[model samples]
Target: MSVISEEHVRGGSVFKDISADDDDWQPTEIESLCMNCYKNGTTRLLLTKIPFFKEIILSSFSCANCGWTNTEIQSAGRIQEQGVCYTLKVKTKEDLNREVVKADSATTRIPELDFEIPAFTQKGSLSTIEGLLDRAVAGLEQDQVVRRATHPEVAVKIEEFIQKLRKLKEVENEFTLVIEDPSGNSFVENPVAPQKDEALTVAFFKRTVQQDIQLGIKADDDLDEEPAGNDLETMRNEVLTFNTNCPECNAPASTNMKLVQIPHFKEVIIMATNCDSCGHRTNEVKSGGATEALGTKITLHITDPSDMTRDLLKSETCAVIIPELEFELGMAALGGKFTTLEGLLKDIKDLTVSKNPFICGDSSTADRIQKLREFGEKIDKIIVGELDVHVILDDPAGNSYLQNVYAPEPDPEMTVEKYARSFQQNEELGLNDMKTENYEEKNNVPAVPGGTE
Candidate 1:
């Protein structure tokens, strides 16, 4: 029996070079029982280091007789000490080129698509922002819920959302990309951003007592410590609790309604219902504020990596445009999110990469592939600080915001303009153009004498 030392494993000397020929290879003495056939099988462990992240162990097992094969990836180092959330705006073609490292425990969501790629369902991957959205689109296409939708409208909506996601990759659409990891192992890289610029907002918050226990952290006397904040106080004071019938089992269920305030956005009324009898749970969000009237357009020039750090808040009613890139993102192309410029670029790149077939799949034309490659290279150059671009946000509802950290003192590279809405734009806002009085007039009905007594 051979003893495997912790140092040997951590130092990554347990595996042979993968590039060597099979005949020239000297197999490590590692052996394990085949998971499928219960026969002794050879195991190979490889160590690979990822830039800006940690080393990982890629282990493979093969049953020589039954031909069973399996591969697994495990982190070679300690678990992350804190959780992380990455919010990215997908506003331009360059934004789509950002690199993303998603751990197995990370959850990704594109609210506009009404799509969420939950943790544990996907293996850890190091891909571009565009690759991530492509995976989400693929998942939606194969989802049992979408495939077996009973209602035609539900199916149609799902298909429409998928199309929107497809459009998001083109330079013509915008969306918000968010990733949350409780383990703090995931990352969305902003390589072009300056070192001093906090391009990525790293918000640190204490994990729940339950989460700490699960992670094997020793608990102290402060386990019962209360969270202090206006938000908590509001939650405690405004929680409206009642009993309701569960939709799943028709059993009596408890419901709680509260007004929750999200930072950088208006308050939202959240209603949550849970049934203890049938294990049913549901939650809904509603707007808790009035809408704005005037339209707004925010323009910012991206010249240096530091510019990518600027915060952006794009409302659902906003349309994003990059005139130089000849791309425009219409309203509701993506849901609202608070993220940096670099994050947004990553999302667009990921979406565009995902829709390559639609973009240039007809003929095996070299010109088409070359053009796509050139376009991708241009985006890559922008991400690495070699190129500059302009980002514009046009919101008819005046709800979008582009953070100017150096306020009072204007940023020379940014411009904000407000304008009156046009006739069509005002109509879209559900304003005075609804034409309620024209129904009878259009149908050639004369005014009913004295109101149709």
Candidate 2:
């Protein structure tokens, strides 16, 4: 495709009657004069929509007479008003699995690696975060700038940089992934978290006049607008709300329902209710999306203090069981909580302390309370790497996840296993009563189950 010089024409014009067929295959072909051979050739054009990005036009021309061929890609949508920057912290192996969309006009940088990949050198791609780093390493390996280095010291430094890029694929290494797209067509899927979670950061900034000119983008482009706030509002409005009778006071209570998206897990509907008459509040969590047929168990040994900093997303269907402490917490014991390992432990300790008053009145019970306090002290020691303890998450719905910071590299302290749900678990989840053989007939299969699947 030839580049359009006129900003207005490039941003405002639309292809005529271009549509995808049943299989989503729509190609427009035309006979055109070849620029190289001066002979008739066929130019085929295909327009496709990129997820999280705008539509792109892929064009190919080939002449049968002189054997001339050319291929190019261009944006079929309007220019963006503001650029986008995505920052992802690669703390563990799990973060590498995050999906990323990089437009051809986007520039990728790894400050820790002291490397930068300029725009337009490679075509746009949808890939995992690790795959992106692999591409960068491959590009640098083949770059003439590194091969033509005159100084031996400079060449050694270049080799070291490439080695660091390779090391990032390992779980032991931590780095930051940054991508900046002037076209505003690139994105890195954020792992679901609360508003304050720093795992992912997205920013939008106005491009300078010179920056736009350099990218062949127009200053007056009106097609691009920040949609993050609008998207959140739209999702909030889609939540289901209704009224329910309070069990205690038999008064009509309003229920606020919201669908929460959990990264690497199925969606859940959170229903919270408050009885104004009795001053009672209750919250219930229901799995909204598809349920996994199999169950998952994640086990991690707290070996270091830094392990407490790792993030955890626990689903309401999951059960946290500490075999070392002979303590088991079921789904009813705790609702879904997004927190670090230390935060989870502290919450459990606080809950135990809340029951201390009842035990204080009896000598036997008072001794048990003292033992509970000692257990809490042990947990604190585990958090500080003074002691080692195992934490297990067992979820029949397969909705729970433990952060894996040192991925690719084997962490002997951690293990994740998937197994068929037991009869009791299936019955508890109401899965035993449902027939899976009819799923294909019903055309309703839940999305892929998380946790090793």
Error of 1 at 332 (Å): 34
Per-residue lDDT for 214-326 in model 2, tens only? Answer: 67754555355675553656765686678876644446889888877755555666778898876877665666667776788999988789999887767777888777776
RMSD to native for every prediction?
Answer: 17.4, 25.0
- Candidate 1 runs further than 4 Å off: 1-45, 59-73, 143-156, 195-200, 213-453
Worst 10 residues of 1 by lDDT: 192-201
Number of the top candidate by lDDT? Answer: 2
Each candidate structure's count of clashing pairs: 12, 3
Residues forming the 10-long window of minimal summed lDDT in candidate 2 = 355-364
Give the total clashing residue pairs for model 2. 3
Tens-place lDDT per residue, model 1, 352-371, is 44334323332225754565
Off by over 4 Å in 2: 1-45, 58-74, 143-154, 193-197, 218-453
